[model samples]
Target: MNAAANAPRKLPGPVRAVGRRLPRMPASIAFATALNLTLRRKFPADVLDRLEGHTFAIVVEDAGVELLFRVRARRFVPVAQAAEPVLRFRAVAWDYATLAAREADPDTLFFNRRLLVEGDTEIALLVKNTLDTIDIPRTRGILRRVLRAAAPGGG
Candidate 1:
């Protein structure tokens, strides 16, 4: 691989500059949308259908952002206010990424208290069990390919 390809990329000037002006809500919504889309593709529809009307929050501590999503309209949608989320999960950004990237296991993380979940235990268990069956790295790879193809010059 080229050394250029190995180097880390800084955010484009426009993105970094606009990042300040852009509100948090949209980014959260977009993230939830991407996750929902990926999950829908990877899992059975009935599984996600069960989430309808339920509210869940994923808090990325390092990013200083919490994404609250309500299952509605047959899809997960981000909401600015959820009086009380049925389930809330919190983890540092890198830790969460490692879990999602399959570099770390969820059970291991939970056992080590690296991943914390709050609220309805039964619901949390249900979500956790469902997620455990998923091949996160594979799903993430596919999502990345789709996104890159959609980006300028990615083809």
Candidate 2:
């Protein structure tokens, strides 16, 4: 392959600017809101109820976003900024998008070290297993489109 083929494509200036601002935005709030609605609808009340009071952090390494969350009143909410997390998951943006889109399996990503889990191992495994079992076609489709749009050279 030529150098051009091997080179990383850059996003357009405007898209790059938007990407830069995304991390600074209320990422935790947005994430919590989205998950609160979707997870609640997809999973049973009893299932989510078991995770009550558990705090988890999602660290998007490439995007430089860290969001902490917890379960309260059977609703998932973003933890306060100062809250210490019990379980933390770390992955690059693209990897996470594909994982959410169902293009990548959790075990595959974990085996490859593309995704990482820190803190409470039991809770981490529980989340991974829960995510693996759920099938949200609509949400996955939306995530696929959003990721494609944000990808370098996609536009």
Candidate 3:
């Protein structure tokens, strides 16, 4: 059997305890990596070329997740250490992943408070609308199917 299949299953509390002991990248970094990989082809060349130095915040609340990304002419550096976000949002992890995979409607998410956008409304809209236009790469199919299978009732 695979290592995972042989591993012991723990309840939520024990799972949390184990999780706390493991080393993990920040959730934001993990999410960003997935985004970059899934949308690399759809990303405007100009945007991808300039993404390295951009400063943006991803705010996630009970509602959903919002990304506030921008490309500046100046050299890349993160400026806002504590300032209010240029873009902000909130959403549950599942809803955010669903939207990313194009399995859920952005409008429905926004209206249901499963997603909320704030900060630089114009920029936020631009980012959100642009993301809506892009499609996740085919590699996501395997991962997506696995996720759906693991979800309650298989999504």
Candidate 4:
């Protein structure tokens, strides 16, 4: 394989700038909706209950976006910045994509400092362990699998 082909891709600066300016509500809504459709059923009800009223933030550094959400009524909902989040995850967009694609392990990323998880250690462990237990079905194409994993409601 060519070295260029193996190189990591980064989101363009202009695109990142646009991403930074994206309205938090809409982005959060989309993210929450995707999570609801894909991982909601996979998460145990008790876990959801435990997460209730707790806010979380995902900061995509390269994308220049911070998504804030809370679990309400056993569902994830977008929330405006009010108080400190119970947990905050920070990483570049490529790292996040690799995670979603299952091309990179979260534990490895965390240990390597490529992925940062802060605040409420117990809650962070709960979320991480919960996610580790999930098993998304494997599909033929990586992109297809990612898309299906993101929006499993279609299938």
Instruction: State the lDDT of candidate 3 residue by residue for 1-155, as single tens digits.
Output: 12122112222454445544543334444655555556655767665454444456655433222334434442222232435655666655455556655667777767666567766776666667778777656755665775577565776
lDDT of 4 by residue, 1-155 (tens): 12112234466798789987888788888888888888888899999999999999999887888888899989888887847999999987767776766566787777677789989999898988898788775521464455345432634
Tell me which of candidates 2 and 3 scores higher on TM-score: 2
TM agreement with the true structure for every prediction: 0.70, 0.76, 0.61, 0.82
lDDT of 2 by residue, 25-125 (tens): 37778888989777777766776777888888887765556777788888878765535677888876667777778766677667667678878777777
Lowest-scoring 10 consecutive residues by lDDT in candidate 4? Answer: 1-10
Question: Which residue pairs clash within candidate 4?
Answer: none
Better of 2 and 4 by TM-score: 4
Q: What would the per-residue lDDT of candidate 1 be over residues 35-153, giving only the tens digit for each residue? A: 77677566557767777799988876545567788877667788887789999998765565545655456767676676889898887877777777877676667645554454457
Candidate 1's error at 25, in angstroms? Answer: 1.1
Each candidate: how many clashes? 0, 0, 7, 0
Which numbered prediction scores highest in TM-score against the true structure?
Answer: 4
Off by over 4 Å in 1: 1-22, 136-155
Segments in model 3 whose C-alpha atoms lie over 4 Å from true places: 1-25, 46-54, 62-80, 137-140
Query: Would you list the rank order by lDDT, best first?
Result: 4, 2, 1, 3
Runs of candidate 4 with Cα error greater than 4 angstroms are 1-9, 138-155
Clashing pairs in 3: 53-76, 61-90, 63-91, 63-114, 64-90, 64-91, 65-91
Model 2 segments beyond 4 Å from truth?
Answer: 1-25, 149-155
Best candidate (score: lDDT): 4
